[model samples]
Target chain A: MANDNGDDARILRLSEQDNVVVLIQSVPAGERLRLDGQELVMAAGLDLGHKLALRAVPAGETIVKYGAPIGSATADISFGAHVHTHNMKSEYIANYSEDDPYEAEDGS
Target chain B: MINSYLRQDGRKGIRNVVVVAYLVECGHHVARKIAQPFEDREEHDVHVIGFPGCFPNAYADRMMRALTTHPNVGAALLVSLGCESFDGQGLKAHVQASGRPGELMIIQRDGGTRSTVEAGRAWVEEALTTLQGTPRVDMKPNELVVGTICGGSDATSGLTANPAMGRAFDMLVDLGAACIFEETGELIGCEQYMADRAVTPELGQAIVDSVAKAHRHYHTLGHASISVGNAFGGLTTIEEKSMGAYAKSGSAPISGLLKPGDIPPKGGLYLLDMVPDGDVRFGFPSINDTEEIGELIACGAHVVMFSTGRGSVVGSAISPVIKVCANPETFELLWDDMDIDAGRILQGEASLEEVGKEIRNNVLAVAQGTLTNSEDLGHQEFCMKYKRFEPIGPECLPA
Candidate 1:
């Protein structure tokens, strides 16, 4: 369930294990925050559906969602950093692995 | 109570419909004027279905004949411009032979649009009267042939509703019923895995060949992205997207492969190859959901099981579309639009098998003439753009 603040701001939860939170409504940088009984400071501007990391994460680590690894971090991400294309890549895919199945001549 | 009207072909239908069919694009406007006003009201007697082509097409002929003879259609009103190459008389004869009343109205000869609309209304009213007297019988679950398709797919689709529907498809197939899964374009990466599940070696190779054809076809059209939502859901490549979309078929053996308008011969599990066979005459494979449903129904699917992660609110012209919502949050947001909630599996409130049984039961209920959300809301979306497909080779279906 999402609640609208006095000025019409909303929050969305992507997954249970996600340490981040998504704003359904845009919020200014340095906005006060209260989530899951934690008092966290906003590190940057937040847009609708963008994630804010609740805790620090390392590079090359997998991002869990629905109790499964949806993708892995492309770079070392600090707490409350937005998790998106700039830092994450799908785990079910191979970027440059030699085992790339599509590259096979006969696709054995 | 489960009630059905049995057709002359020995198939049972949940609803008795009176189809006002237009034979050519020229007759569409007058036919629509006659059938348009009857649009959302469920008198269980009035509905319009047609194919728009001025030229003769064998595929269109077969489809019109099959649909007019469909158990759900008790009678049909054929509107023709009188000059088009479509065999209006032959189609009427087929409908009549199926023990259903068929009437043909030539718009050019009937004193133009006004007179034809009046005549068409009278014909439909008479057809409805005849359909009211048709006998209703009990329908069996095992006698059903259901098809499943997923659109607006995202990451959650593979993990949830698709697998749930797969479980239901497996159950139906085991109960001596036939199940069809389609959209070969969305099935690129998992072709080998699916081929390996074929009941026969030839069927396995055929599966591989069909997927390859689909890959080439989509590539030709520059539609390798599969779904618009694939990009939104963070998918970058065709294989990653295909791997997620293929979860809807479950572990069922690949029983056969069929072209767009081809129906399965005997039925265990069949794959409907939706790609064009030749030099891409049709613009896109399917512009939207209704065209796919129309093709599925043409292939003798009694019901269509549609899965969506982003929530789609659509129904077919002839058959019912049972929507299974995949994303848990999307399900919550669009709860009223869904028929089954496969997202409950994510919440630990329901198991995959439990949701599967619910989906199967819903299919049974809808087959018995129960209306789905889209149908209830009057979503009779239909579109049949041009496409060329060579008939399936014998190797695609093995006896």
Candidate 2:
């Protein structure tokens, strides 16, 4: 949980109670990382600023960040696997995408 | 100490800018034509800001009044289409009452677009000359009102830039500066944490209640506060994006709650409620980043610290926006748009404390007439939309 690499290293655990650690840099699929006195390999490539599950989280469970519930998992999330909108959803409001905001512009 | 323009309202402003406002969408072209001649000139600071709504709205009217008489503005020129419901006369009168020079030109009353543009240009040209005589006074940190907003955010925003900004907010609060952190909609999950940090129990309850109201409102409106850019930048959910956005407020005990156009009563920390009060009658709380930035300026922010990871190239019309870049990659790409690169924390080059001090010093430097990247690039973006907000209650600010 401690690192001399930086105040925040390439992967950072923002709080002790947080169940996920955030990536400060992009990690490849075969990359190795050490957390909680154990070594784990990345299952897939993820970009910088993505999240990695610190431990296995079951579907329907709350996803925790900054020691608080950010939302809920839509599917089972494996440790060191990529966590994103594909696998998780906002609990307060529906999560969807808009391709073009002005789609109905008087239908002209 | 910063040498700043002094307003008769006993407030100090970092910039003495001339503003040309379009009362409705019809007047927009004429207003733009009046201000376009001075856009590239460093000597003349003329900006165009307006509301496009043709229907009369009390919220829009108040916002115009607040912005036209903003401490940073030395004079204002209001252009009206004359048939719109907006009260252009009332807006100009309010500006003049605040001791700033103001003028109104009705396009229908004055000849057409061409004549109104000529009149507005002549008025602004004269106003710029008169603004040269505005008095400059010695101002301290306490007199400075700073506002924070994180836009185009990513996962690194909370870890690197936001907390570093939090550290800067702590330092500014200690210096007796009034700093504001905003948007209850983005702060959905962190309600308890904020409530615990309030100065009083009632204030804490008010803080929690405001978040609850935001949750209900967004749920009713059927739109999430989390933008598509946030998801592409690796922020998954609204709560996840919100926790990152909320970090700019820092650990200061919140002093008060404010709606749009409400000035801070004293020097301390404040939470600006960007959400409207009643049912979701209007559209989204803020349509874009420029609208939020304009609201912060209307609240009397002398300067705004805008932290970004996806990269926003915007600056407000009245106040200079200090862009704090959270991602090193984005910083490299948007070098000309950013002011401070806080991604040093992620790269192991600088700690959060070091970056915090850098942001604090940058705020002071920009306040002392050093132009920010946006200010230098001629980005005076402004917008206002219709919304409803009831005045805050007593418990929101405990003496």
- Writing each residue's lDDT as its tens digit, candidate 2 over A1-108 gives 335533235677666677788877787888777765567787888777788888889999988887667888999998767889878887763222222121212110
| lDDT (Cα, tens digit) per residue for candidate 2, span B1-399 | 999999877778899999999999999999999998888778438999998999888888888988888889899999999999999888988988888899999999999988888888889889988988989999999988999998987667788889789889999999999999998888886777788889998888888878877777777678667677777778887677778888788778899988889999888999988887766677787788888888888899999999998798888888999999998889999999999999887786777788999999999999999999899988888888888777789998778
Q: After superposition, how far is residue B17 of candidate 1 from its true place, in Å?
A: 1.1
Across B1-399, the per-residue lDDT of candidate 1 in tens digits comes to 458887766777777877888998888898888887677557534667788877666667877887777656788899999999889999988888888888999998999999999999888877778777888788776667788999876566765688789888988888767788888777766666677888888888878777776666666677775455555554434554565566567667788888765667765888888766655565777788777887788787888899998898887767778999987788889888899998776554666678899998898888877888877877666666566666777778888
Best-matching candidate per lDDT? 2
Clashing pairs in 1: A53-A80
Model 1 per-residue lDDT tens digits across residues A1-108? 212322122443434565544454456777766655455566677554355555677988866532235467788888656677778765543212322234212110
- C-alpha lDDT of residue B285 in model 2: 79
Candidate 2's clash total is 0
Error of 1 at B228 (Å): 10
